[model samples]
Target: MIVFFFWLSIFIIVYTYAGYPALLYLLGKACRKTKEYEDYEPSITLLIAAYNEEDFIRRKLDNSLNLDYPSEKLQILVVADGSTDKTAEIVQTYESRHVELCFQPQRQGKLAAIDRAMAFARGDIVLFSDANNIYEPGTLKSLVVPFSDPTVGGVSGAKHIIKDENTLGESEGLYWKYESFIKKQETRLGSCSGVSGEIFAIRRALYEPAPRHIINDDFYLAMRLLRRGYRIVYVPQARSFERTSYSKKDEIIRRKRINAGRYQALRYFRQIFPLKYPRLMWQVISHKVFRLLLPFAMIVAFLTNGLALVPGLSKGEPSILRLTFPFNWIIFSIQSLFYLLSVIGNISAGKQGKLVYLPTFLVNSNIASFQGFLQFIKGNETALWEKVKRADNGEQINA
Candidate 1:
């Protein structure tokens, strides 16, 4: 019984990380969706939310102003959610420059700020953005072109990490590349799991008021559309750039919060899983559900393997396949070695050694996710969060 559970956990963990993406790649080839792009022009509301982000507001405004879209057709709205700094003051200056400022006196949360702005968003297509993330010049044009297809209700643009010598940045770049691959394959199979909030657009008519307490607003927005049978396409040509968190410690806070939001999603989105929609369900389970569940499964696998080895070790002559060593002991030792590597990797954080760094990252992520899960259970995580500090290298941070 212990052996069965032990291997079962192993299979799940392996499949979640490696096997699922591989299978998706093969399946994507067989299941294809055709897209037709035309010269489509629709009014776009570029909504950016900021909280105590004085320094970034100007640059983000500059970035928004630079997007290659017709000025009359594009509306730039900046929502300052009770910023205590010069964020609102600086935003006031942009009013003359065709940027509309939505100043809410109280600091509710990101979703609340977005909900407030949505009331005045007078565009056919509402594009959501962050204060720190910068969209490419033609990104808006690319984002809107998909609207020409009636089947595409929402479109998610690519998020590209700015590469630097920062250890976290290097690994984050690699991680996003993997995500990009999955999203690309998902698009080939028709619709992706969710959008990168940095560059995602949805038809204003399909917009729903996101629960203010929601942690992952982008996920909920895209998902609710999918629930209505609208296909959400991921477009790689539409790209936005963001700097990675300066350190793993900083990144963990973001991950934990995101993981908590993911847990929140599971409770509400159970009806959309594999049973109702096989392909969509497979992608969600493999791409999303497994990620949220991995940490708990890891704990189970560890305990079961240790317990399985106890009786065999006590017998002192356990053997497997004509060898004197028991299978349980060997597997347990391997798991132990992996944990040890994780310890060393954590110590070497910020150094680029993929072999050592990957294990450490994996362990730290699971730990953060598990903590996030606990927070959800305790009802501790609120919609608001203290922004993680990134590098002060002149790049404006979206608070």
Candidate 2:
């Protein structure tokens, strides 16, 4: 039973990381005829929810106003949720005539803010954004063009993590690039796994109010549409330029928040795979669910592998213990060393631990997932959260 459990854990970890992506790559090869989307310009409400963002509010409004779209067709609205700082004042400057400001006296979290603002929204389409994430001049045009396809329910824009010399920034940029590729392939297969919250556009008619404590509003919105048999397309041409958190501490806070939401989603959206969506079910299981469960699998694998190393009174090694005793020990040693590096990486400054960025990133992210699991299990996770201080160059926007 020990060996059985050990190999099962190993298999799950391997399948979660390597095997699943490989399967997606093979499936991507069986492509279908591309559908040509015509130019589309629907009435748009650029909805951006801001907490205390006095530093970036002006720039955010500037970028929103400068998008290459007809001003008459687009209306920008900023939701200032319980902001006590100059954030509300700055936003109020552009109110009424240019941008509409929805003020909530008390902090009701992001979902509630959106619910209140949606009441005032008159657009045929709703485009969501983050305060610090700057959109490119052509993002609005690129985002809406896919709406021409009747089957495309919504579209997620590409997030271009700014190139910074810091290891944290570089790793984030690389991770996003990898995500973009996966999203592109998922769309090719049928639909994307979820939309980027920073820059996703949905038809206002299809928009449903998010639960008060929802963690990942973007994913919730997109999945709800997918359940109704609509494809969420990922458009790489439309872009939001963002910078990374200064260090793992900052990133972990954001990651913990996101993972907590993910756990909630796993339960709240349990019936994701209906009878008609076998392929989509496979994609969701492989892409999202497994990734969510990976941290637990890693813990189990580490524990079970250590148990397998105990003195074996039995003569030959079990087939499940495919690696020779010495080799197994070596692999465990390497893994131990990697984890040790992660510890050191966490303690030291990012520049000092630049060489171990990849290992540190993977370890910290998994650890954050575990933290999120705890938060979910304790029923302490909520939509309202303290935004971590970022690089000031439009740094982290909570996940």
Query: Which of the numbered candidates is closest to the native, going by highest TM-score?
Result: 2
Q: For residues 61-84, could you state the per-residue lDDT of candidate 2 as single tens digits?
A: 987887888999989999998998
Candidate No. with top lDDT = 1
RMSD, one per candidate, in order: 3.0, 2.8
Steric clash pairs (candidate 1): 132-398
Expressed as tens digits, the lDDT of each residue in 138-207 for candidate 1 is 9988889989988889999998788767766766777788889888888888889868987889999999
Q: What is the TM-score of each candidate against the true structure?
A: 0.92, 0.93
TM-score of decoy 2: 0.93
lDDT, model 2, position 301: 68
Off by over 4 Å in 2: 270-275, 313-323, 350-355, 393-399
- The alpha-carbon deviation from the true structure for residue 29 of candidate 1, after best TM-score superposition, in angstroms, is 0.6
How far does residue 360 in candidate 1 sit from its true spot (Å)? 1.9
The clash tally of candidate 1 reads 1
